[model samples]
Target: MSKLSISQAAKLKGVSTQTLRRWEAEGKLIPERTAGGHRRYDLAQLMGTKSELSFTVGYARVSSHDQKEDLLRQVEVIELFCASNGWQVEIIQDIGSGLNYSKKGLKRLINLITDHRVERLVLTHKDRLLRFGSELIFSLCEIFGTEVVIINRTEDSFFEEDLAEDVLEIITVFSARLYGSRSHKNKQLLQELKNVARQL
Candidate 1:
């Protein structure tokens, strides 16, 4: 029944100290406080509650249909990584711009997290989740006690290309919304944008 400080407990749990603090606030993982108001976690108690989570979720995304191979590669990588860790994973793949929030797979993943059915979320990279607003999702995960694992924290080789695509998507969506999707102005604007994107 060894007791550990918040940092030590967070390290042992593979989560951040901030996450531990949030969990404490949410009454999910309360710790005993010393006279000095330092939180102390019981190792035995932590270990005993380890099996409560449902399963790990592996999420893979590509910005377009042309990148389906890349999506598959991400899935394979996630599966192998989770297997090495003995994590039972369910792979969810998405084909859409990272800036698109309405993707079916992304919505499903959000639902699972919000429902507290996911123990962990495995990704090849953080941006694979979204070109923007990924942090909001991560914050949601923390609130729901879902651990996020990004296997590759390094800069992505295709980052520039993906960012360009997401930028194009944003422009296209906004152009259509402003000019009317079926209007000639919208079509011309989209074509011009695509041409410029291709030239770069």
Candidate 2:
């Protein structure tokens, strides 16, 4: 009846440390407290057939670096949501275009899903996960036995604004690449043209 620390227990159970913590919060596996109030799991608990606990992960993202405040808000909301549910949550975040799948945080989340380490995934919005192909990820989660939770299901004015901004960013990139760099005078002329188009 050897007692193992959280890390050791997680290793024995083939799960992440976060998963073990979540299980503890969910009352799936109760660990004994050391004199110092540290958690110590009994090895037998890790090998128990009755414990079915898994980790819950929260993901947040903003499409632009300038939206740092929005990113923080998303994280705060996720933390509050998880806390309210009495869930121990691991939060993953990204500061990149939703169309970019190479973001480190996004990649890590996907890897966790693929490894079946995630029992549940919470996102502030579907677009926060990806601008497109989000259904593919959802399908993968289904196959991996991970549940998806979106904090916001209805589209809002903010979503429309973000979509328009993304469209403008794409247009700017293609416009620059196709027309090459413009002289200051030409740039001013283009701005004036944009203003005229807006007025129309």
Candidate 3:
């Protein structure tokens, strides 16, 4: 087997040198060390492998357009994290209620996962992906051999407030459908319920 230097190995793998280093550190790939203390990768192992390569992506979401700044901050953090790890990351952003899974960005993410193109997913927080049923997505990732990386565990109090609003919105929609939106009595009831929801 021929030996390849770090740069050559990185080029062959189509990843950055830092990524190669990280892989080594994570024991995913360990190179032979020279007497001069330089790392050398086996070219055959790096290039002749039959395993498929998958892509990495970062995802960010906000429950409303008012939280656009927060979403941008999440994107910045994800970009910085991927850059530090020397990963070329694709970022997906969504502006919608977490309770609603029909968002365009969320659908795109699911399609990518279904296509087996995603090797890894990075999220700022678990709730950033979904207000609920996040574990379901995690299970799908596991089935697809995709790794999930959550950068922060810190809870945002405002997220709970947003979730309450989402629940209220869902309730309002259903109630309107059941009671008839054109009814003045139903509209008054919805206004009263919304006021109560805001207080919660």
Candidate 4:
């Protein structure tokens, strides 16, 4: 029932308005035309392309300090998957912690969903998009009929941090609370964890 203008649809699909217009002319991405000769796209149709539908939409996010510094690489991975399936992606970038909800980047992403511009959101990892409880985000996405996909769930042993990653992260947090320097507690936490291991 919801409709998006050609421009809006173009952005959601990661294409130009002219491309959409051209596609409409060539029957590539024909949206329902209004009486005024304007092209309007249906979000539902765009999401389900198998049954003669339109391009599906995808969302991606990452923090600033992540080792995967290049968000484009992440976007390309997502975009390639979507593109192969004739889907579109509206990528958003932000520089902050995943646990922080007041992220400007995430706010814009939520706004896009509110405007019915997103269908399925894709994240490389749950921690990339979220850290703690993300029930509110999931609930809003559900309410807006948007789905989420975590591309990678299994932990990567490649990271030198290994299983102690989360534990180290916790130590960092606690250290930050106790003292301004987080790295200061890393040595202590490592020693303590090693000591505890020896006792056990």
Ranking by TM-score: 3, 1, 2, 4
For each of the candidates, give the backbone clash count. 0, 0, 0, 0
What lDDT tens digits, residue by residue, belong to model 2 across residues 119-151? Answer: 779988888888888898899888876778888
Score candidate 1 by TM-score against the native.
0.69
Q: Give the alpha-carbon lDDT of every model.
A: 0.82, 0.75, 0.79, 0.59
Q: Is candidate 1 or candidate 2 better by lDDT?
A: 1
- Candidate number with greatest lDDT: 1
lDDT of 1 by residue, 73-188 (tens): 99999999987876778999998888899999999999998987777899999899888899999999989888889999998766877877887877776774757657887678
- Model 3, 110-154: lDDT tens digits are 888777677679998988778888998898887765678888878
lDDT of 3 at 16: 49
Against the true structure, what is every candidate's RMSD?
4.8, 10.0, 6.6, 10.3
Give every collision pair in model 1: none
TM-score-wise, the better of 2 and 4 is: 2
Off by over 4 Å in 4: 1-57, 66-70, 153-200
My TM-score estimates for the predictions, one after another, are 0.69, 0.64, 0.72, 0.49
**For model 1, the run of ten residues with the poorest summed lDDT:** 46-55
The 10 consecutive residues of candidate 4 with the worst lDDT sum are 156-165
Q: Give the TM-score of candidate 3.
A: 0.72
Candidate 4 residue-wise lDDT at 138: 75
